[model samples]
Target: MDELVVRTEVYADPETVYEFLLDFRGYAHYSEYLREVRTVSGDGGPGTRYALTFAWWKLTYTAHSEVTGVEPPERIDWEITKDIDAGGCWRVTPSEEADGDADDGSRCEVSLEVEFDPGSASPDALDLPRLVSFDWVLKKAIPLIRGEAERVVERAVRDLEESTRDVDLEVYVDSDRI
Candidate 1:
């Protein structure tokens, strides 16, 4: 039930960011933690399911994700179906200054939320030592408690930049999955 929220301003329009968020197939290309991501059903909107396999803390997790909500060029929410109960959303909007020129590439701000406990779903799992808490291992690896989300956001941004670079500019800005 723990939650971490991250917000970042990118050099892209809100629409561009929204469409990019809809492209689930590009996750593995963006974050190394995401070992694989493929559509299981639907497209990128509500009911669209995705099979996601990722590694964290030397363990691999496989989960099914479903898009739960979509508001177009603004917000998209999702829910996890198996493995772990976790989901987050992308909120895209023009920055204050960009309000006057919404299409300017640098005016968009994106907020990402990632909520997860990172522990086994079974209650008995926590009874075993070194089985339920991520605090210890993460602290040893990071100096600050909030650093994990920062790292996630940093890597996500870098991945987005890299993925966009490989695509035609117009595609990222126009095509939903290009």
Candidate 2:
């Protein structure tokens, strides 16, 4: 299993960022790969479970997630219980330059952790690259998977900035690293 981490800064307090992530439904508008997410049980805190669906062109995959941990204004983490071995998290804190509810200075970092072997039983990983599809990815899917995943996350950050109007969310994408 390989792990990839990509982070972006948002001009919102830790709590605000936390809230945004807590509402999984709002993420549908963020990435094309994400179809929609709905709560299956409990509040969004730890132990909460969600029914999530994602797609790449003609291929679609569904999975259930149980939030494993939550630390308000700091971090939140969850584990995927089906289809794939994956996890996600967000880390928020006061930006060094910003204080109070000014919105301009406060920032939070978002990260997603994925651990899946291409040789795994599921075809979800190979089908993630809409253009590359299963055959090419199955042959050597690492680069293709990583690139597509990064693009998905990048789009999410861009969408998050556009939706977050109360603050100037400056999201930085690292093209050099995915």
Candidate 3:
């Protein structure tokens, strides 16, 4: 399994950040490779399913995921239900700077963690050209997938910070293979 941990401090209340993450439909806007996100079932809560379409180079694939857990103003968890074996969680917590004062739109720490195994992912969902082989595409794409999570999180943090407030933000990323 490969894991990615991205942490950032945003100038927004915990609930606001949590609500942003809960809205999965907006996720496609954070990454260029992510073409679209369509709700497949349920509401924007636990048990909600989403189909995320990703396009890169000459390949396009749609992955399905389901919301597994939701804790208001604190956490949201989800798991990939099709194509790939993966799960992730978004955590929002009040920052030390916003402990007691500045209740209205205070600062919060946001973290996203994802664990995925490319070897466990099926290539059947990949839309490939007629002559291309799955093995060749997978060999090339797996390496890119390792770094994709980091890129997405980096963009998410920057965009979230910009959208919420005009503040300079720093994103910390840690990746490991388990």
Q: Give the TM-score of candidate 1.
A: 0.67
Candidates sorted on lDDT, descending: 3, 1, 2
Q: Model 1 residue 6 lDDT?
A: 65
TM-score of each predicted structure versus truth: 0.67, 0.68, 0.81
- Candidate 2 per-residue lDDT over residues 122-151, each given as its tens digit: 655334544565655445434555655566
Ranking by TM-score: 3, 2, 1
Candidate 3 ranges beyond 4 A from true positions: 98-105, 163-178
Local accuracy of candidate 1 as per-residue lDDT tens digits, 73-161: 99989988765567888778777663564354655677777666445343332222455464554334223324444554555555656
Best by TM-score: 3
lDDT of candidates 1 onward, in order: 0.64, 0.63, 0.77
Candidate 1 worst ten-residue window by lDDT: 169-178
- In angstroms, what RMSD does candidate 2 have relative to the true structure? 5.7
TM-score for candidate 3: 0.81
Model 3: per-residue Cα lDDT at residue 73 = 89
Runs of candidate 2 with Cα error greater than 4 angstroms are 97-105, 123-178
